[model samples]
Target: MMGRLARQGGLAVGERIRFDGQVRLVLAVTGRAVILSELTSEPRLVPPAALFADGDFEIVDISGRMPLPPLSLLETLPQPVLEKALWWEGHILEILHGQAPDAPQGAEVRPEYAPTRSLTARERAKAGW
Candidate 1:
């Protein structure tokens, strides 16, 4: 999945993502794609497209997994092959998004209300607090 995300130059608008074992669609965004899930209120911006694609899916047996070409196994893959792999990866992501549950209609569900807390110097001192 990391390989796939790296190949796409990272996630983009319209890309699909998964969270908490369920697939979701990329909606709006601030800096990155906004990922919406069943239990989530506002969409969350995930950092890497790979992470979004790495949602909880059952592991499959690898016995049937195609072996990488001998050349690719020995050395770096050619650009065209890499591009093709990325395209396939993106295609899979699209399919996952298509399978996601439709967003419920009506007024957008309000996120659960949480009392706001004053920021503390200590909290602000932490990264991205």
Candidate 2:
């Protein structure tokens, strides 16, 4: 009874839901989004409001029985996401490696790594920098 209530009113990981006339496994749920694994070889984060707008989803009795891949394994991060992550990582690495702007040569200082009192310079340093 409680499970049925949760399935109807709240999101439950491992639940099998019929959405848009297709079965999908619930992998995770946020305040306004649900991560669902469909048959597209990747999972997708969908807004609950969108599903509610469709008005065609139903909680299956087999809910909470379907197994899904871990969050890290889900191919939900698209190319743009990867690109952004790469850019962020590169920026962070630049700061950590102290590859800051050469103040004398008119190189633009990265906003995140402006020269400060606690400055230390590094080059060719790796992850632990």
Candidate 3:
């Protein structure tokens, strides 16, 4: 049985709720949002209100299994995400060879790494994360 507050808020990580004509599994929850993944592994974060709007969704029986996104989808991340990967590539190169090629003058200050501090400090800082 769902309490009134539960109906208004929280969904557990494994619960499935019907959404947009597709049933989705709850992958995560935060105070402000819920992360849902469809059977095809399409993931999205949604506000609580949308799920409960017009009493639209239903608690449905499901197999309780969800797979990760397909490798092809994982490989083709959006452009902004790909930019971070490029940044990491530059970061790795900087660590290995003491400098990163095609890196902007300020790449060292980019991702909280302090390569200019000292080689040992750089190693320690990178290892911390």
Best by lDDT: 3
Which candidate do you rate higher for lDDT, 1 or 2? 2
Query: Which runs of model 1 end up more than 4 angstroms from their true locations?
Result: 29-33, 37-40, 49-129
Model 2: runs farther than 4 Å from truth? 1-9, 62-129
lDDT, model 1, position 24: 64
Itemize residue pairs with steric clashes in candidate 1: none
Question: How many residue-pair clashes does candidate 2 contain?
Answer: 0
Task: Spell out the clash pairs found in candidate 3.
Answer: none
Query: Which of the predicted structures, 1 or 2, would earn the higher TM-score when compared with the native?
Result: 2
Instruction: Please give each candidate's TM-score.
Output: 0.29, 0.41, 0.38
lDDT of 1 by residue, 8-103 (tens): 122333444445566665443333344444454666656544344664522222121122234444246687887787566543322322211233
Model 1 clash tally? 0
The stretch of ten residues in a row with the least summed lDDT in candidate 1 is 109-118
Which is the winner by TM-score between candidate 2 and candidate 3? 2
Model 1, residue 12: distance off in Å is 1.9
Q: How much is 101 displaced in model 3, in angstroms?
A: 49
lDDT by residue (tens digit), candidate 3, 50-106: 766625476564322222233465358988887787678666545433445565553
lDDT of 2 at 26: 79
Going through the candidates in order, what is the number of backbone clashes in each? 0, 0, 0
